[model samples]
Target: MNEKQLEQMKNGKGFIAALDQSGGSTPKALALYGVTEDQYSGEEEMFDLVHDMRTRIITAPAFDSEQIIGAILFEQTMDREIEGLYTADYLYEKKGVVPFLKVDNGLDAEENGVQKMKPIADLEDKLRRANERNIFGTKMRSVIKEPNEEGIKAVVEQQFELGRQIMNAGLVPIIEPEVDINSSNKEKCEEMLKEEILKHLNELNEDDRVMLKLTIPTVANTYTELIEHPNVVRVVALSGGYEIDEANRKLSENNGLIASFSRALTQDLNVNQTDEEFNNKMSATVNSIYQASIT
Candidate 1:
């Protein structure tokens, strides 16, 4: 029997620092933080930057535990040992923050202008690993580009399909279908996205509960219904390349949407800061985001 126990995902009214960048976006993030090719002698040596970045990300929650309730870590950092302590355990035991793992294999180009998350190979193995480690939750992200009703519905359906598997494995799943902010038809796309997501959730039994990480829509308070959905334990927003201030502005317009921001959360921290400076900057940023999440 799978005796792995699941703790309740009590992260409804909270902020999740998103540091789960895959290979394609990691280099750009490193560059923003002043980690450049010059630091490494060769391509094989580049992981050092990622290592340092992960260390900082893991450490930040300790400074502002009240502001961040959870974090979603990349696969590379999920179970990593920092100074002989497991990263997830350190977040929960020391800082009171939950740790979620990013389990998607990344994205693959599909027939439409949109993309799909690559199929998770041997996902059962991954979930078992998370269960063994006592990780709190899991997240998967797929993108929506244009307002094709069929294509958007397909993405939401696939996300929830994977979500059911995650839930059955005893993990809370955050189903993130990120609609591109650059699209000309964003309002139309959001309406379609909302319709399709509700369509699927209505089919699910009462036991099928999940979280949502979405783009901050321009229409004010439109997601109040989604946030209030009984099956939706929480509804969070993604920065999706928006500046942190702008992301906060849109997030504030909706009553219940909080933040699961990746770039926006980490954009301000620099590689050259002293330890004191780094923690101060991180704490300050978290305070700003936390304030936005509640108000």
Candidate 2:
């Protein structure tokens, strides 16, 4: 789960936290975040992490069982074939986990960002098959689209179609607008987000469960724009490589904030640090957000 998903989960009684990456390195880093192999070890370590996180959130005073806890499985484009799809399948098999699949928007592609086709097609096919398999209670969410002016409309249309397919197959669709700090025009960025949400609303039913992803800087500005839209149900906050203090400040300002830390958590844990140092930072970060909602 990314920060936006975490924020959505936080708003409800149940909260979902996603483990960053899959494979050998990911588990070790997750261990630094206070997730021990003892608690989540073996062939089912990935599955165990999902279970443990859910249990912790459910036991927390802030969580409500009436609201469902959503857990997202994120896979980078390169890794999708190896372990990514397998992870999603495992989460779907587990009754308690709500799996959200994430695919990278090909911002790096040179040709109007349309050149990156395989991953998008693979993701769509995965969702289609998951539906065919009757994988109940699992949803699919795309990360924001690429940050390019010419490509924005095309990406939005493509994702909208993806969402429609997912919903038709009995899964929820999470709509995310691409946000890149390098973009020169802030207004253009906002316009792109609004346009995508508007398109989704116009095409889908008003009661559809659609969520939007935004960075902290845009939350205050865009929250009102989305609040009244019946199709929008959740708002997610993307950290965008901001410092912890900056990230926390933005989250505090927003009502529903999801904090995603992939590079930071992975880098910090990979370094040589005492267990105490690891535990302190990990617990502090996780607990601070958990505490923020209650107070």
Candidate 3:
């Protein structure tokens, strides 16, 4: 592991950029960037377009370590090159930001009001590739739609189990069991999810540290205990469909948690914007998120 990168993750002043939209979420992301479905035909072309979008974001003058500490990349993006360097390498060496890779294949159909991650058939190979590319961590997601204790327990267990596998491969894991923000039982479900996560966290050795990405809680500082855990590197909150302003507000209320936002971070950007326009927007976005994270 890169100790310097780990220190930055543990004590950084800014938020993580969730640029890891997969095959399932890529279309929506592109549409938000003003690239409609009709612009790309096949899957290959589709991925290429998305890569271009990511490249534009990474190479932007405002995308350095000033107010952005890390970025999460899709598998395809991890394998691609930017400025004649591997994507992860560019982020770490040139931009002074940590890099993480998204490893889940996607989620299964909902069962017991939860959607567990689909099996990652070759995670070992993927982790090996990530290590080679200088990625410092990994993120996978599962979803909880209700206060079903049984289902929430299963989801948290699955996350920690996969997390251990990633740890064995010498990478930090960001365990994300997202509680559906729109669920009728959103607050109750978050409580249950927290309990389950703590149960599993208590079983780990002190050296077996992990990060967490969760929905912004219904109450401020709901994750204070988790944030203080010795086995937790950091606790971050996902935007979970919140707009940028709302997300920033909620994040500021949580003392120790930071932002790991996707759509909220890129919502103001457009593919056709001039370079100056893009950089200005990025600068504003990064500053807002950084301020919220440090509050």
Q: Of the candidates shown, which would achieve the greatest TM-score relative to the real structure?
A: 3
Candidate 1: what lDDT? Answer: 0.79
Candidate order by lDDT, decreasing, is 3, 1, 2
Of 1 and 3, the candidate ranking higher by TM-score = 3
TM-score of each: 0.92, 0.61, 0.99
- In model 1, the Cα lDDT at residue 295 comes to 65
Per-residue error at 115 for model 3, in Å?
0.6
lDDT string for model 3 (1-295, tens) is 8899999999988889999998989999999999999999988999999999999999988888888899999999999999899999999899998999999999999999999999999999999999999999999999999898789988998999999999999999999999888999999998888888899999998799799999999989989989999999999999999999999999999999999999999999999999999999999998898899997
TM-score ranking from best to worst?
3, 1, 2
Per-model lDDT: 0.79, 0.48, 0.93
133-208 in candidate 1: lDDT tens per residue? 7787789989988988778978998999999999999888999999899989888888888989888889888977
Better of 1 and 3 by lDDT: 3
Tens digit per residue, CA lDDT, model 2, 1-295: 2344334443554333434344445565456546666664574656456334433332333322232345445443112321234444434343333446554333334345322222455666666655543332233223333445566665567667666766676666665544554445644566665766686577777655666655554545455566456666555555556665655565667554454433332334322455566555555555554443221
* RMSD in order of candidates: 2.6, 7.8, 0.7
TM-score of 3: 0.99
